[model samples]
Target: MTPASPTPPDASRRSRGSIRKTACCLHRGYPVDQLARQCDFLEVAYIMLNGDAPDEASYQTFRETITRHTLVHEQIARMCSGFRRDSHPMALMCALVGALAAFYHDVLDVENPQHRALAATRLLSKMPTIAAMSYKYTIEQPAAYPRNDLSYAGNFLQMLFAIPAEKYVLNPVIEQAMNQILVLHADHGQCASTTTVRAAGSSGANLFACVAAGLASLWGPMHGGANESSMRMLEEIESVDQVPAFLRQAKRDPQAFRRLGFGNSRYRHRDPRADILRETSHRVLAEVGMSDRLLQVAMALEDVALTDPYFVDNGLSPSVDFYTAVILKAMNLPSSMFAVVTAVGRTVGWVAHWNEMHQAPLTIYRPRQIYVGEGYRDYVSRRGERSAELR
Candidate 1:
């Protein structure tokens, strides 16, 4: 009876149990339930990997530290000028993430708890700078320096679009929208890329090396790649009238329609998060006066799909990505940059999870497999073995 497939293990026994024991990256004993909602990506990240939310003082200090490091070091700024404008932002993002390793090689080498804490601090501090610089260079703009007084989201906004010719005024709505998206994407129990980060970090690898591995995993289309897919789907439909026909085709042949942005995950019927993002999309779309045919089409499709029995039974719904793409697109970001935005928000969680694994009574991740190959044959002399094998 296959040994009755072993009983579910306790969270406290993660170190002793086989890797297949857990369903996802979530450490069962950790306070994942408290964190999966209510916290922003940064806060949840700190909680998961660090085992506690930052107290007011720590939160303030960490926020300040991150703000201080939000602009690229001048050397990185110079190097970025080398890439062509048409290059994909992810290529530049990967290079920049790796470049950070060079900047803090000494910090990474420190093994003391205090020193490791500083390394974590530096990484959290520098992420926005690295992400912002990548965006600026890809668009051929002089990097906007980070402002000390602005909120974390505000500073990222400035770095992305502020120009020498004009002062960049921060908009409250846009910043809130960005923060919401970041919070929603903070971490997913044990996602593929996050698992990659943990596996790489397991050997006591430095944070940069681990984060690079995570970024590579995020580059897969089924994961972060869906952000671009969401935008493209909206564009393909192009207007409200097309929504019904598209819905009909999709319903009649789900294989043919596939509902690009709407149906990807376990929370079928409608993502609670989608309602929030949809509001933001509307606000941004109206702000930008973008009355594109695609927007109308997407809205129409959403209306039908939300009411459709097909989607309800299937446990599929428009995800956070669907609304997020429209909001970002309205804010003037290219689809290529969508996943990078996801990566930036996710870095906080990634680093935190890496830290969490370190504090755990450490286990090297090794999954087991049943042996299924043919039984081994006895060794023999080359020619003798060949003749005897047939018999």
Candidate 2:
């Protein structure tokens, strides 16, 4: 008998996993880990914006351009004042970014490459300033102006933690940790917020508006707020002795336990970003002399979870959000500001996605939805006769 002919591959199923499979950054074809280790956030942003690492002259020019834009428009400061003192930073950030379109209408043209570039630069440079302002506004502290003399991360630290009399000294170890956090979060291809940016940009909206939409999406607990939730969970555990009980509860009713940041959607074994952050968290905690009982609890919990067959079978590994919570807490950031920091780091990614979508052959994004409801029904007007029938 003749051998059976080979069956052709299914075209419909071929692209099912393509989105996750192709998610990556190819800055000069370097792996993301290499980029995160070798470059600062400014250098990473340069690569994202210009598609390559900059030479000396180009690096100076780019750095200067970013530094010049670091100071937000004064009108933006006034707009931030409108928010209530108790407002969430993420909510304030979402509103402020949307308001940027009104303040910067002069550069709102997506079709003009120069306008797009300008918007990207302004958003990338000023996000930290905006985020810090939101934090200051909540505490009724005067906003600190951006100091161009500091590095990007240093400037943000100064703005965030500075006060009236004392001069804020930037610690080298904390600055390095902050840079690593920013670079690690700078981009993750087509994540929820990035997709939101692309979808809004597809409608030819202004760049700031597109990013505002992305910010709104990022505010969801499942996306950018995971670290905040993780930090809260660790606090609830309270100590290493309590970790086993929490794990038992988690295993009993997963919904009740609500494991906030254990596993990632993309990485089954380990998130590469988590590896860098885990080490950084230890180093920063050691250098900063911050006592974090939660970090100890988290480590114990991770040990318990990893050894369990249930967690192992389900691919439950610590993700970027897990270690990030510890690091940010060690840095003295409140849990509420955790997501805002993520938003600040991710602004460059959102702008880059918006720019890329506009530069391509543009098409409005409209996804098809399955109709699961009743197909058709007779129109019934709420008139006298219908009212009598209902009665």
Candidate 3:
């Protein structure tokens, strides 16, 4: 079983909005930025769930444990086959992830600690497999089996791109980019999806169901599609030369062409995650061996945002979303799979938070709200004249 405290691991110094303003609140003693850049995805997840980095021996066992569960049941593969060929990958993922709980329904006693640990491990391992299956199904291709020999991220890439005839020889650059991408997005404190996961988990739902809720939350463009939107914004600018004209329009009518990916409430200055991703963006692009015009446009925008007085004064800097779009584009993944991929990375966090939420006494989350609607009004049926006048 995964090593963890019986109670939810304490956030070292988590303030209400600290993570939104700057770097992640310390996980136990480790800063997440350092973990994202240097460690593998599972290593970072171990830290998040266990409250400390694993020793060499412990990590080996942990790694083996994670890999052992990577393969979803054959029934899941057959189940994925039932989806429409044109279904969105996220839609497919949301459905099948929830379906996974049905197969394991016998042991879903959420109160059992070992059961919770098993559930967490299963989810951390299975989500990528499901995501890859969803992608393959969308493209009318067969799903690839998970490789025990590959690292977590490497296996995911292989499952995603490897075909029957040509085995995917893992490229170091590609694998490194994939690993960092997963690590970088593994967690950001209490985002919409994470909150949804916790809220669902608080209600005594199974892990798969809670995580599926998180997946559904991420399906919306506002949360999960920002990077894709960033790509769109960059594409609209087309060539680097067109950025100036686009900026002029943005300046004249801010609402007409809203600039995305330049800033967020999460970081007042440079997003530390963006800095880490930027360090490797060029390397991945070079490895991709294609001149991506949209990536060029993104960098052009980055340059302007960095030096422009307007952007500087407003604290508008490039964000993690923009760099993600650049790297995923260079890696040649479809926009449809972008959010699905991100959710795969973030499953670690979702699981970690759920584990934490269930540590002590579990309470179904109940948020109080004041009623502001018309009060003590008689029911307005269609027969009423006012009801006939308006909805």
Candidate 4:
């Protein structure tokens, strides 16, 4: 994996097939490696996934574009208004995403090129709104509408907590950290969720339908649920003192907690993004004055696991999930909200990929497989007795 050499847009467009993988990150292009070196991950995602690198103006425009879509729909907000304040944020998030599918039914019903572009724009814009609204609803707060004038990061912060008394003053460090996280997590080529998006899109399902398919894939514990599970592991340790032993036990029997985070992919020995996120988590924890003993334990566990041979043998590295919990918790967000935040940032990449697919004229994907079962069988009527040999 290396930084992408400068190539003409047409050349790059044609280069896609040389890179696409059905299930792994692009089997050919190293978008993550290229992104990790130069541009912020968000911008790289827009380019690599969307197929065009946005200039400064375009970047600002899309930033504003996403912000403009962050407002909660009046009807959806009303529906959620009646739910218990203590209900999990993910529950509200799920409903909000589904409601959005209904709210944009007009676009869903239209299939023309212009209509597809419009729907793409609408979905890209509105995802953050739905995610932010879910958080506000969980807290039973009056949802703050999107302020068009704010930068994407600023606007998202405002939507999450809008009142002046407890206003979110954007910090450069935290904003950069969040942007990095978005960048790193944006598009792992043909990840389970991305594949879901492509599969549904291939069927000519509407944009929302495709997004919902991706969301369902993300809901699986083996995928997006890893972040939530990682945090839970931290909670289980409870203190720095508990970390070494936990790692030893985990090392002692890797399969015992194979279900946990830090050891699934066959890529890097450690997820490359973890180092940056671990630093960001430390900075955030220090800045926010959050010193959960659990966080300390998480850090210690990270150290032992990184050095341990068993983890190294398994290609187990601290993934994005390992640090997301700490970062979100430090930001005062509950565990349930992390996945939605992940979705909000990711929708940009999803639309970009969808748009790219539309341009290339892809047919509905249908792969063939070998059938190993008996090739011929006789049909038996209810009134007829089957021969013992046939049975």
The lDDT of model 2 is 0.80
lDDT of 1: 0.69
Q: What C-alpha lDDT do the candidate models reach, one value each? A: 0.69, 0.80, 0.80, 0.67
List of clashing residue pairs for candidate 2: none
Give Cα distance to truth, residue 314, candidate 2, Å: 2.6
Q: Report the C-alpha lDDT of model 1 over 1-391, residue by residue, as the tens digit.
A: 1453376633312331111112222322343323333444456545544555688787776667666766656887787878898888888888877777787777685245665677777776666677777888887887888788886667777878899999998887788777777765666646788888888877777888888888888877777878888778777775676777767666766632444566645443455556667777777767767676666666676677677788767654566777777777867888888888888777776776776666545556655567788887766765676536756
Q: TM-score for every candidate vs. truth?
A: 0.82, 0.89, 0.90, 0.81
Clashes of each: 8, 0, 1, 2
Best-fitting candidate, measured by lDDT? Answer: 3
lDDT of 2 by residue, 1-391 (tens): 3444497522311111112223343443556677777887888888777677789899999999999998888998998778889999998999888988888888998889989989888888889999999999998899999999998989999999999888999999899888888888877776888888877887889989998999899888888988888988988886788877788778777543434888676754666777778788779878976456876787787677668887766666667888888888888889889899898888887776676666556778765566688976555575635534665
Q: Which residue runs of candidate 4 sit more than 4 Å off their true CA positions?
A: 1-45, 48-50, 82-87, 109-111, 164-166, 255-259, 366-391
- Give candidate 3's TM-score: 0.90
Using TM-score, rank the candidates from best to worst: 3, 2, 1, 4
Cα lDDT tens digits, model 3, 273-366, are: 8878887787887777646788788778878877888766666667788788888888888878889989998898888888887666776666
**Regions more than 4 Å wrong, model 2:** 1-28, 253-259, 306-309, 383-391
Over 133-177, each residue of candidate 4 has an lDDT whose tens digit, in order, gives 778877767777777876555566678877646756778666766
